[model samples]
Target: MLQRKFDEVVKKEFPNAKDAKDTSIHYLGKMQIEHQLDISKVLMATSVCSDDINVPSTTFFNVLFGPFVMGGLGGVPFVGQTGMTAFAHHIPDNGSAFIFYGPHIGITLEGDLGKMYRPRMEETGNSCGALMLALSRLQDNDYTPVINDDDYQQMKLEESLLPYRDEILGSDNQAKAITEATYKIIDKKIHEYIKTCKNEFHVDKVTLLGGVIINTDYGLDDYFDARNFEVIDLKGL
Candidate 1:
């Protein structure tokens, strides 16, 4: 009953979202069948948020080689070009590469777009704490993030969203809006990094899967709204 409510609530914001676990099955099957990627040899890398709550979103962790985590907050690939190059180097011998990139937003059973119940928790909290924090700060038009080693990643995450301030704030759902902007940023950067580090990869092709993760309450399956899925031939690049 609780899970059903969550489904309805999440669908209100993302009508096309599918179960996150189902998403993994669909993509993994596509990689093996249509693309001829060897499932045993494929090394997976995730450019999603560092939130612990997101770990259960997909079965990639159980199936893939390495989710060489590239993202920090709001799905920003904090490791940048160097990380991509390193990730390319980590692929299995003669195996292809799979990179998953996206941002996540939480929705409650009662229909709140940015809040959810964590594991064993009684109250709702920000799933993408980094993003929600950025949203709180972004509310102040005069605010600017200060770069420092201690909070560099968080600051950088906030700085990245500045350009989308108006688009996020002006939306009917600020949290969902910010998450969407984050998806665009993450998608752009992932492609750029892949292009810059193409030569580093010995693999013939790289599969890119980018999407938005819809987080729900604990014990309930999350959802994924796939925005892009493409295989890039390194030889052409």
Candidate 2:
């Protein structure tokens, strides 16, 4: 498992962190943990960097998932770079962190979250890094941000997919219906990812952060069954 792999690595690098009961990760890293894990509630936050062009244009929506559930910034400086760096230094080394990169689903989501989160990308100047700092603060054991097999399955449920309510519905040609084709493609990939992890972990809830996630056009809370998964809009807080 990714967490196990990470925990092993952390044990070697920061031995002192093992004692800390809590830690935090910044920038969401490369892994994640499902809400079903036996852990305490950790604070999740995201921001819209004043500058955003540095982020690749292909995987914006995927990026939102990392920060929202784990915690971090988008692409700005103080909000993203400096903040993430500082946050990482403070975490006791036992907690977890999650960071999202824009290129993962940039081409897939069609830049919807990117344009919506910071409509005036030209004006923001790409300084979104608060969440990144938060992720960096985590200790490998204290926090686990990787997304495993179980987490992927829970994310597929109509309710789990609700966080992306806007992308599923919109005003442009891309925004119409959750077509069978699109769902099929997403479902295939999701199922494939789930086959490798522990069965106990599941994406019961999703936390959203970053400028792109916050500025999204669809109000997931409005249409989706909030009872299933709570969407934590982590833009300002």
Residues 11-108, model 2: lDDT tens digits: 34223322111111321321244333222332222332223432222232333323332121222222323344443333223333323211111111
Say which candidate scores most in lDDT: 1
Candidate 1: tens digits of C-alpha lDDT, residues 192-214: 99999989998899999999999
Q: Candidate 1, which ten residues in sequence have the lowest lDDT sum? A: 2-11
Tell me model 2's lDDT, rounded to 2 decimals. 0.27
Candidate 1, number of clashes:
0
The 10-residue segment of model 2 with minimum total lDDT is: 219-228
Local distance difference test scores for all models: 0.91, 0.27
lDDT of 1: 0.91
- Estimated TM-score per prediction? 0.97, 0.22
